[model samples]
Target chain A: MSSLGMADKVAIALVLLALAGQLFFQSARRRAPYSKLRKVNAYQSADLLISAVAEKGRRLVLGIGNNLTDQGASLSGVAGLPLLKAISRRSLFNDQKLQTVSGDGVLACLSQMVTHGAYQNAVAVELFQPGEAVLAGTTRFASLAGLLPEVNHRANGGVILSGQFEGETLLALDLAARKNILVAGSTASLGGQAAFLAGVCNLALGEDYYAPAASLETDPAAAASLRAQDLLRIIIAIALLVGAGLTIAGVL
Target chain B: MKKGLPIAVAILSGLFVLAGLIFQPYLGPYLGLVLNWAVIVGSMALLVAIASLIIYHARSILTARKGFIFSIVILASFGLSLVGGLWLGVDNPAYLKWVGAIQRPLEVSLLGLVALIMTSAAVQVFRNRGWSPLTVSFGLSAIFFLLIALGLLQTLEVPQIATVIGYIRQLPLVGARGLLIGVAIGAVMMAIRVLLGSERPYSD
Candidate 1:
């Protein structure tokens, strides 16, 4: 083993903290029968839209943005897969179609795989349609242009944007608005978050984008993850406060 | 074993990567190898996705689906681009310029439209959310930042006022850092989940 650098030490500490948090929450969940999750408007609205679309027998679209393979965004890209799995599990049995559009090739395949897994879990493996997950475009704008048709024509119920997206998401938001399709979105990108805040009121901003499984109650581990995030946030806030105090005191 | 195997592979690979990160001096070359493998696999996935996309568009055309015309246009463009890339070689300067010429303008125009749409969305935000605490703060902060960005605040040369402006200018960065920290924590939690085999997106 190599000697740990400061960054490595910090990384290890964070990982251990998360693991401890997860185990603590998991044990706590076993002791208590209830797990209360704070309500998020994005997931709540998405639930309504999914049911409404299912009732109307219209297609529901999930847009996994184009940055899945991007160096800085690979984790954000994979983060949406769990959300996709939850969504596909919920909506796959409906007679209405559940389609996914991705800007990146690897993301499209992963989405297809997740949907397939959902179908398998539901014992509807034969009904799984790989083509439902489409690589709309490889680049950002091309993906936006490719996605608009899906949003405008097929998303009769609504579209859920989850993944890393840029400001191009606004154009999709604009079309979804005009079409009267309910749009709920979450993006890791700050620019995309700003657009969502301005355009689509039902959005998961900042770290909330990563809490889909917890918000939807799809996985217990997801709930644990949420708790861990909360713990970390508190610790960070305290650290920042202390740092500021120390700086003011000329002791930092 | 089908489900178990993917989970095992995922957990092992994830742990290996984490270990490599923690032991970079000793394991850097192995990490590089694994990353190269990932790159290759990703490229192959891309190829498969492109093929599937072509099939999807071709099927849309054959079935005479609504807006199938767009699919035809997409296929034609793809075909032309493929032919050009193959015949002229992707490294050729002319080919690179030709692709860039089409790509750059489309991206720029879309960015312009997004700016216009974003401007409109500022109004949409107020209209839809209707002055809730969050929206009110968002609106005020947005206006505050926009005004500051326009250098309207710079005309105030008073020492106290300049100091306040300096403090105010740091607000965006502070907010951004807060968001980044939260996002980073979330990302870390996700990686941990994958490593622990608690949430398996690959198999389940």
Candidate 2:
């Protein structure tokens, strides 16, 4: 095969252009609206989550999953942070107690996000204690083990497991199930398998994790990125169909 | 100052790591070597955690606190596991056999305990929550049923049930695939947020 074919070169150029456009729009602070499909469940589960945390007067265990600094890009963590902020804001607005536990060094980041959310809702910073919001552990099983007891003992009102998770997610879900807590879970690309195994997540947000933040916060950059992603998915789907057709026709 | 410094270090280190990722072809090996030092530091932190666990347990034992027996068991397990690994070697068949024997019962018992807890909790929720519980219960039960019906519960030896369950499990993959595709797109957006420093995760 040639080092670089015409089609390959064009494809690479398109990808680069898309990435560059994304970077430019993100930097410029452009907001994009939901591309028709995602606006479906805008605030369906949000009210329940908010009420569970704010009115119920029970602790909210926000498991940010195993995506920490050492754990790479943490696509799930990014997606979950906005949702955490939104939930935290609602909790604070309702004068409800909100506690977060993270399995990675992202504790500081998560703590700040929660603190900021609290601040936005005119709540005290002291309420968002670094200790309360953070539990440092590495590895999935260890994190889950460390977290399960806390969730159970606290009688957490709502358990949000949004981020990158793995096989250990089953253990967390099992723990939540045992505790009779409201559990909402969303995973990024890597978390699909774990998400599949979780039999009882109340609100299974799937990839629409970014939707809560994007739709709720109206974060323009996130919205724009989501739009770009929609375009990309459509393009990829079309490409797949074409490829399949060609294959079926016995074309190279 | 204490919190600030760590945050600062995290930000600097994170930026370096991101830069390394972007220019990995040229900087990958050297960056990897630097990250190996990070691994060593992390391992040392793990040691601190283990030490903290020992200290807490020892304190509990001396104070005759609740779950002292559990502490003793933990300490004994830790000591025995360490000694056995070092003296008998991790690969030693005798050590493996002893560990496995202990492990099997512990695992099975823990799993069984979880199952019991889940059952009790489910009953309590249904009993107490009333109408609202129905939606959640139904969703959870459906998923649980599907997961079990699928090959996940195949070890129980009901082939007919497993076949039906497998097809049911396969049904959701299409929706899951769509969701995954959407998530991938969102992830790219998030990555851009990080790379452009717009998200500012390290910022307080």
i-RMS, every candidate? Answer: 1.4, 5.8
Please provide TM-scores, in order, for all candidate models, with all chains considered together: 0.95, 0.64
TM-score of A-chain in each prediction?
0.92, 0.76
The residue-by-residue lDDT of candidate 2 on B1-204, one tens digit each, is 844665556656766876676567777897998788777765664465455556666776998976588669778888998899999999999999998898767666656665564554455544433556554754576668767756467877897977777686685676668777666566656665555554544333
lDDT of 1 by residue, B25-136 (tens): 8889999999888889889999999999999989989999888999999999899889999999989999999999988998999899988998898888878878799889
Off by over 4 Å in 2: A1-37, A40-44, A67-74, A89-96, A105-128, A167-180, A189-198, A202-206, A210-212, B1-25, B37-181
The runs of at least 3 residues in candidate 1 whose Cα sits more than 4 Å from the true structure, single-residue gaps closed, are A1-7, A31-34, B156-159
lDDT of 1 at A127: 95
Q: Write the per-residue lDDT of candidate 1 for residues A129-234, one digit (tens) a residue.
A: 7788999899888899988888887536888998888877889898888788888988888888887887764888767788888887777788877887888889
Query: Mind giving the per-residue lDDT tens digits that candidate 2 earns over A1-252?
Result: 244567766555645655775666555554334444355242445547667566667777776666655656455665666666666656664444565666665443445455555664574665543344554355555566666665675546767776666644656676666677767666664443433233356444444665655556445666556555656767778877998899999994
Model 2 TM: 0.64
Query: Lowest-lDDT window of 10 residues in candidate 1 chain B?
Result: B195-204
